[model samples]
Structure formats: C-alpha cells, structure tokens
Target chain A: MPEIILIDDPADPRVAAYRDVRERDLVGREGLFVAEGEVVLNVLARSTLCEPASLMIARKRVAGLADLIARLPEDVPVYSASQEAMDAVVGFHIHRGILALGRRRAPASAADMLAGLGEGALVLALSGIANHDNMGGLFRNAAAFGVDAVLLDTDCCDPLYRKAIRVSVGAVLVTPFATAQGDLLEVLTAAGFETVALSPGGATRLVDLKRPSKAAVLLGAEGPGLAASVLARATTVAIPMATGFDSLNVATTGGIVLHHLAFAALRD
Target chain B: MPEIILIDDPADPRVAAYRDVRERDLVGREGLFVAEGEVVLNVLARSTLCEPASLMIARKRVAGLADLIARLPEDVPVYSASQEAMDAVVGFHIHRGILALGRRRAPASAADMLAGLGEGALVLALSGIANHDNMGGLFRNAAAFGVDAVLLDTDCCDPLYRKAIRVSVGAVLVTPFATAQGDLLEVLTAAGFETVALSPGGATRLVDLKRPSKAAVLLGAEGPGLAASVLARATTVAIPMATGFDSLNVATTGGIVLHHLAFAALRD
Candidate 1:
C-alpha cells in the first residue's frame, strides 16, 4: 500500500497536474490523460496496459477508497486534500472526490492495427469526428460491441484528449485503436478491409446489411456528416431509417451496425 | 415572401434574433434557440405547433425557399443579410446562411403524451439525459425507428436548446414530445405503459425482448446513469454488451432497443 500524502492546501505543486481541470475545456499541450471518478480511476489502475501517474482524493471520501489506493505503485503520489481544495484545483464541483491522471501511450499505427487484427472482423473507421466527447462515445460503442479495432483518419480529435478519456470512462484506453494514414477508403483498401460507408439518404437499406470478408464501417461527424469524398471512399450502405425521421448519430450507428454484425456472425 | 429585408449592416436590429449566437454558451437565457440549414427550417415552417418568428438567408439561397418562407404571416420578419454580415452575427463561420429564430414553444405535458400514445406502441422516456447532443441523438434514433413519441422527465436538458434542435435536424420540433409531471415510473405506469429500464449489467437479455402491451423505455444519462429508484421503477432489460465493455450512451441504447421493438411490432 502506498502511503497517502496529506496536503490540505490548494497551492501544493505536487497536485498541479489536476489544477483548474475546467481549463481542459480549451485546448492545451496534450500528453497526460485525465480521468474522473473512482470507477474510471480503478479501471485505469487495474489495467495491465495503464499505469496512473498520480491519484487525488478528498480526505472526507478517502475511507471507502483505501483498498484501491493502497494498490498503486509505491512511487505513485496519492495526495489527500480537504474537499474545498480539491474542488478549487478542479475548478468545479466534483461529487466523486477521487480522480487519477495517467500518461498517454503512443497509439499504434494503422498498419500495426491491421496486422494485429489479421483478416476478417467488423471495425470502426472514423472521419472528422472532431468533438472529443463524441469521439469517446464512438470508442465506447466500438468497445461495447467488440469491434476488432478503431481506425481514426486525419481531422479526427485526438483520442487521448482529456475530455475524451473521461467521457469514454477509460474505454478508449482499453479499445485498441490506431492513427490510420490517408483517407478512410484508401487505408481500408490497402489493408484489405472492405469499407462500408453509412448514409441516411443512400439507396441501400440497413436490413440488407451483409457480412463482408473484412468489414470497416466509415462514419462521419454529426449533421454535416461524411464529406462526399469520404462517402465516395466506401461501398456505401444505408441503415433502414423510417420515413419521416432523421438518422442515427455516427456513434449510435456504429453500435447498431456492430450489433448487427455480431448477430450475423453468431448465426454463421 | 415577407419583402426580403436585405441589410448590409451587422448592427441592423431587424436581425437581433441572430445576434450573439454564442452568448447562450456563457449563460442560459430564454431568448436562445436557433435552427440551421434548409431541412430544419422546412420542418419549422410546416409545424403549426411551433412558429418560426423569422427566417434569415442569403439572397441567392432564398430562390427555392420562397413558398416555405411565405407561409409565415407578413409581420413575422424574414431578415436577410449579405453573406459576410450573417457570418458576423453567428460568431463562428457558418455556411448555412438560411437560419430561423422562433419563439420557444410551451413545453408539452407528460400526462397527455401517455394518454395520447397508442396502446401497443413504443415511447422513449429520458431521465436526466442532460447532454444536449445526446438528447438530439436520441430524437434522431426515435424518429429513425418507429417510436411513437419522446417523453422527457422533469430533470432533462431542454430538447429545444439550439444545439439539440439542430443536431436532431429539427426532428425535435416535429417529434411529439411532452414533458411529464411526476417521476417516469409514476406517470408512465399510471398510463398503462410497461417501463423497460436499460442497463449494461442488467440480467434480462435483449435477445429475449417480448411483445409488450404498451412500452416505454427509461434510459439514464451517460456515466452515473439511471438512479436506483428510477431503475427500480421499471422491468429491467439488458443490452447484451460485448466482453469487457461497460455500456452505450443513452441515445444509442434507445436506438438499439427501439429497433427490437420495431421488429417485434412489425413481425406481430
């Protein structure tokens, strides 16, 4: 068990990494991935692939978390502060007083991910998914349905963005992903992945979705979604959207298609 | 068309509704609700339930929009600006020169919605689903499938919040949503709605979804999700998440579940 350090002062430089957490709303030098709440922190600390740089817990809430904090690496700092100071450092009220920050691992390259996954599996290929929270949600959906991996094209938000890390509930850390080169279509083509571009207005219906030898689903940002070229880059498929209604979001669409694939795979 | 009041000046009070578009981000005020692009504005124009107080478009974009804009009574202002001034009013650059500002409609009541829905139809009831975008996505999914209507609890973020309305492609305006008075369990139960609470850890698997007499699904906010009391209020059904994943967002979960209900109803 690592000994917890008591620092009631908000000015302690040791806790500086957690300072003004709301400042994360604006862009910053990206490296450290910030995680919120005990659930995400516990997931990070426990994952063999993730190691926390430090942990912060308000003294009042420390009793329930002693067991989890005890397991941190001996040198990892566990700073204890009054709830007030913790709140000040984070720049807003945090009901869950405990938070953990971890170092960002270099993401695998697209070629490496393709090599690792081998031949046939359904995976997510993201384009222009600029919102960090939406990016996280997309990853969360990908992981929830066991997509082989995610291939992020250029212009997508960094998966390690702090809000993304928090929003994913650490699922981004678990879901294997890579920064793919070139447009989504070209990458999938070179990798021998069948690109399936999802569209609302396209002629194909979702009920007609068929399993491919190696499938990669391409989704664009919400509203002004996948650029026409981005759409042009794939063997397009349309979800069976009801008439007089709009379509599912990119993230939700991923989940539905992934679930559909999973079901078909089981029957096969 | 209400004589195209073209103003070159950004300060023209006629376009006051379009001024300071981003101010809503800094503070919540009753004055903010924006609909963007032609598709959304068309829904607004056709909706007798909600009126667009005004419409804004570039002189060229207005060519095909004449009959749509003409439907508004003459006094209801249809403001236009040179493309440059319109950009100035919106803060960030927007190519969707056609915009409209409408008086926020009075929120509809929940009791009426429960009574109004068909006995065997689907309804999506949202609990504390605060993210404006998630609400938008949920509406998109609801409309995409054949869900009867969206019923929001008291604690929800406003569906008509500018971002939600736009993200939903203005489906939020057309979808017959009504805010309920009591807790979801009480209002929905009193109206003979069978509540299906969605949880990742839920024991009852979705593959076994039954044809219900009348159905409403209660989805919680992302992360901390449905309160225990709320979960207790419904017959719990689990979306079979893949190995090692937590769950999907409120909207995606709603979409998948609605898909099942739609299938069940269609088969029946």
Candidate 2:
C-alpha cells in the first residue's frame, strides 16, 4: 500500500506541482501530466504505459478510493487534504476530488511502434490537428475502435494537454502513440500499409472502401483539409455528403471512418 | 437591396437585441437568436424558415459583404458600426465582424415536422441532450448525412443557442426541427417511421441494421444512455466495440450510425 500523507496547508512545499493547474499547462515538456477525476485516476493507476508519480485526493474521497490507493506501489506518495485546502492548491473547485500525477515512458519512434503491431493492423495517422479538443476526441475514438497505434506529425498538438486528456476520458493514457516530423505517408507506405486520405474531393467513397490487411487513415484539421500533396500521394476517399454543406468536425469524421474500417476488418 | 444605416454609438436602440449575448442566453423564449460569422450570417439570410430581424456588420466588412447585403430583403435593417462600437455592443471582441438577429417562425409540432418529410425519410431524435456543443455537433452530422429532419424531446437544449449555432456552422438554420414534450418515439412511430435506439447493450449490431424506408434513430445523453422505457419500445442497436472501452461520444455515435443508414438506403 502507498503511504498516506495528510496536508492541512495549500502552500505545503510537497504539493507545489498541483498549484495553479490551469495556468501551468504542464504536460509534454517534462514527461509529466495530470490525470483528473476518479475514473481517469483509476485508468492511470492501471495503465501499463503510464506510471503514477504521486496522487492527491480530498480527505472525504479517501475512504471511497481505498481499493485504488492500495493498488499503487509503495514508493508512490498519496496525499489527502480538506476540500478547501485542495481547492486553494489547484486554484479551482475540483468536484471530482481525485487527481494523479503521471509520467510517460520513454518515447518510441513511429516506425518502432508500428513494427510491433501484428498483421491486419489498423492505424490512425493525423497531420495539422492543432486543436487540443479535436486531438482528445480523436484519441477517444481511436481507443473505442481499437486502432493499433496513432501516428502524429510534429505539427499536431500534444495529446497529453490537460483539456485533451479530460476530453478523452483517459483514453490518451492507454492508446500507444508516437509523434515525428517529415512525410507520414511515405513512412506508412514503406511499412507496407495502405494509405488512405480523407478529403471533400476524392476518387473513392468512404463506404465503398474495402478492408486491407494493413491500413492507415490520414486526417487533417478542419477548415484547411488534408494538404493537396498528401491527397495526391494517397488513395483519396470522401464521405458522401449533402450539397452545400461544410465538412463534418475532424474528430467526428475520424470516428466515422475509423468505425467503418474497424468493422470492415472484422468481416475480412 | 438592404438599406445601410450607420451608427456611431454602441448603445443605439437598433442593436439592443445583440447586447451582452453571453449573459442573456436569448434564443427561443423571445423568438430571437443571434447568428455570428460570415458563413452563418449567409446561411441565416437564405433560410426560408428563419427570418432576419436585422443585421449588424463592422464598417470594414461592409464592402466585402456587399453581395450578401444585396440578397437581403429591403425591410431588414442593415446596420454598420466601427469595430470599437461593435465590440462594445456585444460585450466582447466581435472578431468575426458580423452578427444577425433572427426570429423563429411559429414552431411546428413534432408530428407536423415528421409529416412534412418525403418518403424514404431519415430522422434523428434526441432526448435529454442538454449540452449545447453536443446539440450543435449532432446537427452538423445530421446535415452531412442528409438527415430529413430532427426531433427533440422537451428536455433537449435549444439548437438555436448562439454557441450551438456557431458550432454547427449554421446547419441548424437549414435543417427542419421541432421540440415537443412527449414520447418522441411514439410520434415517430405514429408517423410511420421505424425507431432504433443506440445503446451499448443493444440487441443488434449497427452494421447489421437494414435500411428502412422511413427510420428514426434515438440517441440520449452520454452517461445515462436512453431511458429504459424508450429502449424497450424501439429496436436497440449497438456499435461493435473493443472490450474494456467505454461508449463513443453521442454525436460521434450519431455520425457512424447515420453514415451507415444513409449508404444502406442508397443501396436499397
């Protein structure tokens, strides 16, 4: 069981990492991120890829989370404070009453992550998805559909951003992902994966796509869709849409395409 | 052509409807709602169901929106203001540089809206969807899949909320919708529509669902899925998901189910 430390003061030196969470935005730079709420904290505790550095909880919530606390390694510190003190530390009312600080394992190259997957793999590759909300939603969908791994270009936003993690409901913690610079399509193609790009103007309709033994679906940000060069290099697929309507949200689009690909692979 | 009226004062009575928009939440109660941005303004101007009460544009954007202005009816007042005045009127930076006040027509009953759809209709029925962002995303997906109409239970949030309208990219203006305080499934059933409820425990998988000549998919809010009574009354459908994962977002769920239904109907 982990050690339980009682904290009465918000200014306690040990809780400095939890101060002004919204203003800090401390996720990617130092391999550290925060998992908020009971559900997310549970997932973080059980996640194999992420390790909890420490935990903080409201005094009232400790009894409810005893089983979870007992599961943590002895080296991990667990701190409990009054609701008022916890709020003062976080600079906000955290009604969820539980939070865990996590550290990501060493980074993996996109190629190394993909090479470990078994045959008949389905992956989601994204470029220019700078919006944190969309990034979170995409990770959530990726987990739901069982994508083998997610590949992100350097231009994409960090999936571990606090809002992104919250929006994903902790999916970001479990889904294996890698980010790198350069041509994402060329890398996938060299890995013997069928590359498909989603665009408004494309040669093939999304529903008509046949399942491939190895596949990667490329998605771009909304407004300015997939770069023209990316579309030119990959097999372009379009969702049949009503005339005069704008494209669907990027995350929603990813969900639809990924759902189709997932089920199609099952049939094959 | 709309008559252009220049106003230097932010407190002018003509633009009172667009004041303190965030605090006022004025949409359906007084038959007035505000539309922002160039694209949404254009959609509101052309909508046959929603009529514009007046339009306010930044003085700099007036020349750029000349063609859109020409399309507006002469009776609709077109007010132009300096950027500073426009920001002061809306209580924030009106970066989009455009705003239009719209008045909703007499609401059609759920039955009336369903009755007006053509044969082989596809409809979306939402219950207890109180979040404005989800409501907006649902409409955007509905338009992308060419849904015939949308029916909302009385518990659902107003789709015309300013945030929802903006998030939907103005799909709310073009899609026919109605809200009533009763069993939405019964209304759809009475209108000769097949009803399907999406739930994790659904008896049939979504991919296996056959297209019906007239169908409506029932979706409830995220956490407490569809009410038991509603699920019992309609055909329950599930998306095949990986083990140990939670359900997809309600709006993303709608996109996948609707995409399948739309294509299946075409094949039929």
- Native contact fraction, candidates in order: 0.85, 0.89
For candidate 1, give the DockQ: 0.57
Q: Which candidate number has the best lDDT? A: 2
**Model 2 pairs whose backbones collide:** none
Deviation in angstroms for B91 in model 2? Answer: 2.0
lDDT of each: 0.78, 0.89
Q: Is the docking of candidate 1 incorrect, acceptable, medium or high quality?
A: medium
Q: DockQ for every model, please.
A: 0.57, 0.83
Task: Name the lDDT value of residue A190 in candidate 1.
Answer: 80
User: Compared with the true structure, what per-residue lDDT tens digits does model 1 show for residues B18-60?
Assistant: 7777786447546546788888898888775577877878767
Give each model a TM-score: 0.78, 0.96
Stretches of model 2 off by over 4 angstroms after superposition: A26-29, A265-268, B26-29, B265-268
lDDT over C-alpha atoms for residue B62 of model 1? 77
lDDT of 1 by residue, A53-96 (tens): 88888888888888888788898888888899998888888788
Q: Is the docking of candidate 2 incorrect, acceptable, medium or high quality?
A: high
